[model samples]
Target: MSSSKKARTHPQYELLYWPGKMPGRGEFIRLVFEAAGVSYRDVSNEEENGMKIILDMISPESTGDSDSNPPVFAPPALRIPGEGKDGKALLIYQTPSILSYLGDRLGLAGEDEAEKAWVLSHALTALDLNNEAHDTHHPIAVAEFYEDQKEESLKKAKNFREVRIPKFLGFFERVLKGNEKQGEGKYLVGSKLSFADTTVWHVLNGLQFAFPKELGSRKKEFPTLFETFYQSVQEQSRLKEYLASDRRFPFSQGIYRYYPELDRQ
Candidate 1:
């Protein structure tokens, strides 16, 4: 290849995610770039023997010179090729952190102090809700199956549906409803879109898919919640395209799982 082409071949950034919807993270950060028509490579998978390969790459020993900059968790990390003033060559992780960083990069973060705070608050809240959601199904242990702890699952699922799901969704509904009073916006936090909007959209999508009977039956009660989701998918062509694309991936054994026993009141 030519020298010019060789330079072009270098990726500007690398996104590390367990390819496919291990619920590695929402496609939001990835979708942000896609929406902007930028290119990225997902390094969640390698042509190798096992999960060990992926784990080893992130492990302290395998990282070679870069081990000290490792993140708190592996899924959904990003690498920007250039180093800045701090000598940090733009490697970052934690879904929210990455999203927030990208928001600043892409000019999507809300414009004002109040808006910024609201966007961050909204984004973090959505993540909190998502963790609770996963906990509902795996109340016993993540390593064990829902079927393995069917009895404990039943009890936990009962609490989730009766107490938790409604509680979290209800809080979001209140957040949306309070936007006008709080001077937030039509979106979750600011006058413009942010990671918060994306996160909320996914939570609504996951909850709707996960609990059709409980959350699904009561959709009419949360107009703004549905409105944000509806508008987001329709307007964000990249996200809409990703959702329809193979890269968006299918939901499975990672975070959000459909447990009929859990949702079936």
Candidate 2:
């Protein structure tokens, strides 16, 4: 389907996030829209004065919008026009919540109740890894600069590479192995693609970029996850096109960051 057709079919979904090249948590939402081939407005990236729009939405004094929705705590909020009460736009935040809602709408949740449960379970697990990765760089305090916490970061990153990485990757490899009868090591829950697969793929991609040496050395241990699942998720038609296009941003100072000292020796 073409862009125009997608625009007409799906709601004019607006994604509000920090306006920059960093993927952050917003990238998870972007991956979903891309994989589903849906049209959405990346408010911070595409709109003029997008930064102000985000600030205003998350402002401390703000209570709630005219849409009757609650106040947003942060960015990566989704606004769906006419979805709220009295035909007003609905605003929602939180990455996992947004993914869950969109997953159901985009047919990426799962085929049944059981599969849906597993999809969310696996996605949440992947997000846990994402959070751990962020902490590796900001071990002491999130507000402090990485340079100030370099000593602690080194310790955090070392343990992350040696212990946490293998633990998370091993879990996913087992998931793929258990579902291989249906998923063929490609899908996490059912036969088709789900948000869970996309979620895990992004984390692994970030890890590979953030700690290339650490991941490269361990790839052979998790063949199903690295060799099959990771490669297959990115090659999905719509995701592949989006990744190759300018819409996708490379990891930098966001949740994933490459620090030479923090990686394997």
Candidate 3:
């Protein structure tokens, strides 16, 4: 039995995130689980005291015990109960790290060492794009409200729309073209669907939601590589159903906020 296959032992998986309608970083992890047909409890929505649960886990008090696990700095953490070293709970945090770990376990990272490295590299790049998109609306500081930094956000948004978006999209397009030349199939890293493809799809989806007008106008520049890749992911039966279902949260004040003032063509 392969390790990846063995990892899917039907262990109790719980995702800890903010309880809201908006899909923040948690959505990326959700997509992987959904696509792999792995069932997990979304504690943020299902549990009555999900937020409190997360707080207690990350609190200083929780880490005082010699047997207690290390603290996770933020939300979108995955908790595998009784699966850690010495029978402790295993908590994985950070969007990229969590997704990469899940990808490896779910056979979405890649088949070999070189392909796995490429997948990680591309996934990190997608994360970079996601962060940049989020910063468009919260340029000054995450602690401050969007209204508090509207002026700075406008400048940042303009620069992002004019410069950063194109650079990232263009790089992906080139990657797609290169992959095609190498006969690696339509997916990003290899002929098969990998986590890198899913991460890129999420970033593109977020971009379209945040800057529909701008992305629409620039659609002709990158050819159909990215669009096709995104459509391919959407067509996956499990993911398609998840996307249309209520389980998939809509974009609002989250990372991909659509502010008319910040949007441009």
Candidate 4:
């Protein structure tokens, strides 16, 4: 039978995301790589590696002698280097796709086919919720800043807190509930950790940081999600250390923002 595990070839990966680390779409992939203890460059186009990111994506010159596939609209892409020095595959767009590829490549995915499918399902579910959380701020105007959308954000945030949060929370709870029924804990799958856990942790961190007032009041309501989030935070040694360290960066400019007016109850 073919091996489920893949050999690590090159650690140098070009993560084409925005410059800063805001735990956005790219973060889902990063959390897995971080957890698996893999080494990567994490090149972003807008922040630090902005120039190269631009050249690699939109710049036709970078295509060289190979086929082209740049990101459709924005960041969170991957460039897996090939045989020679500059030989790479331009994997563009979509969070779930990137995470799935990274998971299989790193051998941090599921055990069997069923387990892989289950983990991926939950992982995609988490991404859906992440996008929803982002929509609260830019629900009305994606082009404008949070300051410009405060009024809509305030109203939208309330809806997110009351309606959206519970619905998604319930979905996650059931996933956990299902896992428990199958006699599993610690992670989202029947046993070991997977993409689902990391995605949950990232969203929990964003929600708690962005909407403290609503998150605080409504947090205790989602028992399983809250508890799982807390446990994930505690047990994730590298992530915990990253949270405390400067490498993980701070939350200010990305998907989840802290606008005092929007945060309060």
User: Evaluated with TM-score, which candidate comes out highest?
Assistant: 2
RMSD over all Cα atoms, model 4: 5.2
Model 2 TM-score (2 dp): 0.97
Cα-lDDT of candidate 1: 0.66
Worst lDDT run of 10 residues, candidate 4, spans 1-10
**In terms of lDDT, which candidate is stronger, 2 or 3?**
2
Better of 1 and 4 by lDDT: 4
Best model per lDDT: 2
Q: Write the per-residue lDDT of candidate 2 for residues 1-265, one digit (tens) a residue.
A: 2245543777888888999867999999999999999888888788889899999999999999878999999878999998888899989999999999999999999999999999999999999999999999999899889999999999999999999999999999999999999999998897999999999999999999999999999999999999999999999989999999888998889999999999999
lDDT of 3 by residue, 32-128 (tens): 8888888788886887887787777677655532336577787888888787779987887898888888888888888899989998898899899
State each model's CA lDDT, in order.
0.66, 0.92, 0.82, 0.70
Residue 88 displacement in candidate 2 (angstroms):
1.1
**Over 4 Å off in model 3, which ranges?**
1-8, 60-67, 181-185
- Give one clash count per candidate, in the order shown: 0, 0, 0, 3
lDDT score for candidate 4 against the true structure: 0.70
Cα RMSD for candidate 1? Answer: 4.4
For lDDT, candidate 1 versus 2, the one ahead is: 2
Which residue pairs in candidate 3 collide? none
**Which sections of candidate 2 miss by over 4 Å?**
1-7
Candidate 2 vs candidate 4, lDDT winner? 2
lDDT of 4 by residue, 1-265 (tens): 0112545555566677766555667777777777776666666623565756645565544544253554345567766766234455656567888788888877656878888888889888777778878878888877887778778888987788788887877787777777775524457776666777888778877888888887788767767777764575447776666566555756776788777766655
